[model samples]
Target: MSEKYATIYKTIGQNIRRYRKEKGFTQETLAEKASISMSYLTKIEAPNCDKSFSLEVLLDISSALDIDVRNLLENIYSQPTI
Candidate 1:
């Protein structure tokens, strides 16, 4: 992926982590709620880990988190390129 895409993924991961904590959910809990594996969630949330996931999974996560999919993507384009 390009740097821009990497930054987007990084931001999405950070936002997911933030929202997950705000909702008082463990990674495992969120993973189970999203019907995804814990390891996959872990990879998505890990810093500097630009794991690419499908939109369906993203939607599943938003549904599980009870938030908008756009929320997870907040500030993605605003991230500075290196």
Candidate 2:
């Protein structure tokens, strides 16, 4: 993947995790709510450079967290790029 795309994924992953933390949700709990495995949730929290998460999964995560998916993604892109 290009650095830009990889950065986007990782940054989104980080933001999801940060939000999850603030919301007092654990990986296991979030995974259960998202109907995805804990292992997958872990990956979502720190997605690999080459990994791609589906829109379905992203929406599932956003729903699980009770946050606007676009806002969550927008916040990451708002940061200065290296």
Say which candidate scores most in TM-score: 1
Q: Alpha carbon lDDT of residue 67, candidate 2? A: 92
| Per-model TM-score versus the true fold | 0.91, 0.80
lDDT of 1 by residue, 1-82 (tens): 5665787788889999999999999999999999999999999999986689889999999999999999998998889766
What global local distance difference test value does model 1 have? 0.91
Q: How many backbone clashes does candidate 1 have?
A: 0
Q: Which candidate has the top score in lDDT?
A: 1
lDDT per residue, candidate 2, 1-82, as tens digits? 4565677888788878888898899999999999999988787687563556888998999999999998558666665664
lDDT for model 2 comes to 0.81
Candidate 2 residue spans exceeding 4 A from truth: 1-4, 47-50, 78-82
